[model samples]
Target chain A: MKKSIILFIALLGLASVAYANESQIWGEMRIQNILGYGQEESLKLGVLFTMLQSKYFAWVFLGVLLGVPLVFFLHYKIVGPKVFPHSHKKHYAFNLFHRTVHQIAAVSFLVLLPTGFIIVFGDFFGGGTLVRMAKNLHGLFTIPFAIVVIPMALMWLKEALFNLEDVKWFMILGGYLSKEKQIINATQFNAGQKMWYWVAILGGITMILSGAFMFFLDFKMEMLHNITGLSQIDLLRVAAILHNVMGFAVVALFITHVYMSMFAIKGAVYSIITGYVEEEEVKILHNAWYKKLKEKGKF
Target chain B: MSNEMSRMKFFCDDHRCIECFACSVACAEAHELPTGISRRKVITLFDGIEGKEVSTSIACMHCTDAPCEQVCPVDCFYIREDGIVLHDKEKCIGCGYCLYACPFGAPQFPRDGAFGAKGAMDKCTMCAGGPLETNSEKERHLYGQNRIAEGKVPMCAAVCSTNALLVGDAESVSTIYRKRVAGRGKGA
Candidate 1:
């Protein structure tokens, strides 16, 4: 913390020297008259400034700090410490291929998010060395991330689709904050899980597209300009904006998804790791899918 | 805003420019810039045309609210009192956000290390250099000439044989531009 303060002071001093060379009076008039701080310019500055200085994100963190506890207190008040009783019996929930795909996706997301943040918010992470390293690693991980996204989307597409049963699951809050055991007739995934899947799939696709547009196509900007009616500048601007928006959404979803899997749900993380769940646990949670398996003589 | 210093702007007279490339050469020579980086360039709108080709020496326009400054995630860029948008190379991540953000394609990058990775962004500082001390060796190495600090016109504008490139206060430059256009009776 002391080091950070010292670094901050040094950087500010350096900046002041750069700025002080010019007349103080001219700067103000130039901003008001020549620069014309238009709405687009204002938004760009606002977004980039927030990323650099973290002033806006400080408020976001404060909201998260206050909101998370409020949510926890509400959940505690409503649901208390209710845990389902289950016997020690195992049943197949995920196949080997599904587990493999999930593992790849999980690892990629974990690596990509932090690296991406470091590159985008380079000011907070220190000088060019760390930022360059983060940028390189972020580029490298994007390849695996892009490859995994396609397979993961295909692997979970059918299970993630919304159905009439999902409506009932939503009505009961997916049995999340209920003291009574509301029998949610969900298949392999509940409404909440399905939502997570879709967000990851769609958001991941957007990130891949925008990232690809930024990385490879930049060199061929002239060709792109001829092919597309829009100028290369406009395309790049749109890509940057899209990349930022999708990045924020994906990160938010990933945090909540990880928290729910590891802490909120019992045996959930275990099931993902082992590719199996207790038969009694499946009977209570995924009763619809369990009944189908039983009728098929597979359970 | 004040009598001491005025908001500066750069203008290139299209009619007077002859696509000589002298301004570009003068800028590179004066700055002693790296081989790959050209801060100023003579851009021809049409090539191999009889009396239809229009060319102008272009560089950073030193925009009032520069998009490069606005979009830089590391906040490396800063506009001076004279509206000369300068950037700190120390703070720059070389992510090319400025390149993408700039409408004029002003930002230049040099390949560094093995496999030609992008090192840092180099652009027309408008002869103002960077955040370093005025006319310092470090400033010269990173940001080229500091002629603006020394109260001299930019090398590109200075060496233009036809007096095409003009660099001064925006008000004075516009007044000159208006007279030149009115004399010709056609806007360039």
Candidate 2:
């Protein structure tokens, strides 16, 4: 009996030691603890911040900030009377669908960029009031931006697929930077633009899949959820990284594509915005389609 | 509440715990842990003779003063009345500081992300409720184990087939442990 009591005291001493050195378990349990706290406050704060950074607002700002001068320069310097001296006319099929896609893409990209930046940089910069504000807006705008881009991807799926023509155009560097007036039978969209389209579609899908997995953490397919074993917050943390990386990559691609379409290519802007291009310019750039349309008296 | 202590503690008889993973399975089931995350793990530390191996089951000790609570940026970890250190999953950022802070490497992260986002910090919580209101679905989904609410002993202690793992009030548990150690001619 005395021996049993001594053993009991030793066990009690060990238990006390475990309690005293609780910090040893610090590495094991911190993330789940933080997640529990975030669910109470940060998540709601982040969603709210996401709304203020909506693509619609960002696009409108971009239009006022950058589009005004771009439109003026393109209209006056490139496609103005001094350049080609022809009146503009609209192409029904190309004008409507192309313009709509442009607008949608512009808005989606604008919101996606800044919101994405915040998600990536918020931790590095410290989640201050401004960072918190930006996070909320980033989360909010992702919803509509994702919605518009999905259908846009489906709508343009046909032209974006890889083909032999794309290879030739890629080999020739899309004939934009070079002074070569290389005439090739081109389709509705050029090779460079087609490449950009594919990048945007594929990258956007990656972001959406990763993002959706994060957003509906509680509602995902049981098998997948069971396999992941990640908390919703953990998935969001990962999605935030992917979304930011893809968002910036897409934005960079957009900047180059936009610069090419509006500035580098002389008649491209007019064709997209005013829905028209001079018949001669079309014949030079899109020889095969131009010939087909002219034979039908459609150009 | 601060003065209250846990009724269950895990004690591994160093002689009997042969480094097998049976305790891990019992823990996973009791907690309903997803496949990739194990709350309890047996770690073997072999030293001395070539033929001899020493292994111990390392898990959350349900510390009375848990360090996980201190290092958490969001303050999500909480010590239950029973001294189990549980945490909320909603606030986790997957930053992985807890892994560094743990001495026994009890915290395990799933290698799921491309850039190595530490999947939520999952560790033994002594089968106690987390930050969620006890017995809620949110608690079940996030924290996994909730044995304390069910009025049962932790599964790791109960299912240890070798009777190597023991759980109960700290005092009673120590008494049993002391007797076993002395009977085996071991020192404190």
Candidate 3:
């Protein structure tokens, strides 16, 4: 952490010549005016938006959407699946409410990600009826995801918070780098899972907000003028930029979450599906939680 | 020959504009646009602020390097040889990326989406119709008028009370603007 802080400070001071080679102050200023911030301009944010939209967003999104799966394929080939023997003994992990919320979030994500990509690389499909259908489907799925996102955050907030043991879990990369059955320091949810929780819930909310702005073009940004200080047009620009940036993170993290849940640990999905975990699987993968349960005589 | 093959353009002189909405109204009436759609709009900045007030009419402008063409997901926008930027309404998904990209806010989406979001895009076609055969009934209904093919000036410029809006060959348009500025003693 000390080294990271020092490096961060060093990088900050390394270049005093702070100027955007990719100038887009006008766009950012417009956004500031719309969101009711009343600022002169968001120079850096505009530069970033201009750079992303003009050149990088397509390539970066393409890389993440396609590259992540290729990476999982290699990982699977090397480490193979960690299959724990099924014992009739089980522990209830998710209740009906939890399972229902998870399903809603999952199904919405499944629809949104593909349709979002189709909209991103819209011209690839020749900008016709097919892409339009994807655009519509993308908007429709936002409703379900929006409903469950807050609940998902509230339910998982405690487990998703970082603990000292999570640092150790990170060092070993959650024991997935090797094909060995290791008693990991993770509780029910590991550091990686915690990261996914924040990105999905929090990032999902921001996407909903920004998507709403773009979705309902007629929705007035006037009342928000004093608070956000952005013109309506510029606010839309910021929303579009933010939505794309969030897409990059969500796509990468969501793919990892899916792969870990379904493929990395065989039969791991049973917990989510039936709200029961195999006794042996819990004892090995989540020893910390397993020990607590055992102490309480729940095991 | 130059007017036919050269770049077409629009220039809205703010000093001459009266904020009467005549250009916008002429555009809609001539094209028989829907209740809310305005192909040309007059914006008054600092309205009623005495000397600070300034108004200008704006439309597609048909930019040579249009940003909407760049960000469009469906590649709907195309530039004609005469430099009129047009889009095929059939291919438009109404996703509104063009609305975000446009500096002028030219692209307008009807609230006709699958949800209450949007439908296919509607925007200034520079009086030039879409990919359909020029002046067809379907083209007229989907994209308004095909006045460019009819060998007439776009109605917005034609009916401008103050001649604040002008559209034609680039050279002619600039010459007119230069003349206006010189007469106003604002040009060197």
Candidate 4:
């Protein structure tokens, strides 16, 4: 009888702890552990949140915001653009559907980057209607990006995959390091483009999902606990960390992609809009793709 | 009057708190708060005792180094000389960063935008109002009454029957805490 009574009392003891008791001690209530700091995960998350709010994220962003543009400026000044004719025989590269999706994603990203930077360096603008508007637009623009992200991924997935030819492309920097146009062997998408494609699609999806957690604040912790064994606040910490880390990657790659299209290779930006690749430029820059077309007797 | 210049703070005496929603009700009524907003809440801290209950009132403790101020992207928060943390509603984009950083869960948001998007952040202003002109019509409209400007205690503390919710200078509050601890023949 004593053993059975002890067993029943032990179950009762376990029940109290399982009932979401804020205090870890069986009877003592700790004021410090109230609210968000109630669990060990909550405590660790608090520390992370503090580090995030401090100059840590800002200093890292400063490197990207200041450091990247300087490299681009140097590249522009020294190497010069690979100039190509705008009007030429259209070597059909992208279709109307592909062009439309690319344009929408590009425009959305164009808005997202600046606004997101504004949010990252928010203290500079000193909060008001402008930052608030930026915040709202950031969420609003996510819709278009989210809609096109999947299609964009599937369309470019096969071409964006890396192969041995890409190794050679990476070695010579895709023949973009010099002024003189050199014939380069690159597949439909070069090594640089393949890297960009993965970053934009995968990193963008992670950023979107993480941003959603912050946007919708009313989602219950219990539901999240059932899924991730974490409280809502802990999940939020993870989201914020993921979002910021992905933001860094997206920002870096987006800048590179923009530079490669608009400045590094002249008239390349127009191809996305016009849905045509310059045949002469493709022959020089995409030698492998040009060879494939020649073998097929298309050119 | 001189005490107003000291760093302002709140100390809820956990021992005496009765969980009577007086402070919360008084704050809501005094501020004419929106339906979903409450600046002060009494929460039960311990329920292990068979019949006795220990509870405490919680709100924005208005920390010396306020985390909300640190995390706000818009630089909306500004601490006064007396250490009461305040923010500009006009500048707040309602991004909810401050909400995440605040351990107390002090920042409150009214669902104003479409699909329940957060409006400007609202929290315990410590009866000091916001960045607008003191006690002006616009200030009152945006941030409720400015009791501090009128030389009065915050409404919640003023109405606290058990004196559990203490609000004053840090030194004064700590002195009282020390006295209460000594009176109980123990230390917190």
User: Which candidate gets the maximum lDDT versus the true structure?
Assistant: 4
Of candidate 4 chain A, the 10-residue stretch with the lowest lDDT total is A21-30
Q: What is the TM-score of chain A in candidate 2?
A: 0.61
Per-residue lDDT for A96 in model 3? 97
Give residue B120's lDDT in candidate 3 (0 to 100).
86
What is the docking quality class of candidate 1? incorrect
Alpha-carbon local distance difference test for all models = 0.70, 0.58, 0.78, 0.80
Ranking by TM-score: 3, 4, 1, 2
Ranking by lDDT: 4, 3, 1, 2
For candidate 2, lDDT tens digit of each residue in B16-109? 7765678888888767787666677665655455666666676777655454455443445666665666766555544343443333445555
Candidate 4: pairs in clash? A127-B74
Candidate 3, A228: how far from true, in Å? Answer: 2.9
**Candidate number with the higher lDDT (3 or 4):** 4
What ranges in model 1 sit over 4 Å off?
A1-82, A85-87, A221-228, B1-5, B32-36, B46-52, B111-117
> How would you encode candidate 3's per-residue C-alpha lDDT over B9-34 as one tens digit per residue?
99888888998989888888877887
Cα lDDT tens digits for candidate 1, A1-299 = 34543653464355345433432212212222223222455334323432433334433433554565567666656666435444566777778877887888888888887777677667667647777777767766776666667778777888899999999888877787766666668897878889889889888877876765555323333354577644444455557667776666677667767756665665468788888776665677778987887887765
For DockQ, candidate 2 versus 3, the one ahead is 3
Superposed Cα deviation of residue A127, candidate 2 (Å): 2.5
Q: Where in model 4 is the C-alpha error above 4 Å?
A: A1-43, A85-88, A221-223, B1-5, B45-53
Task: Kindly indicate the candidate among 1 and 4 with the higher lDDT.
Answer: 4
Q: For candidate 4, give the docking quality class from DockQ.
A: acceptable
lDDT of 3 by residue, A220-248 (tens): 43356467765555666788898998999
Worst 10 residues of 1 chain A by lDDT: A24-33
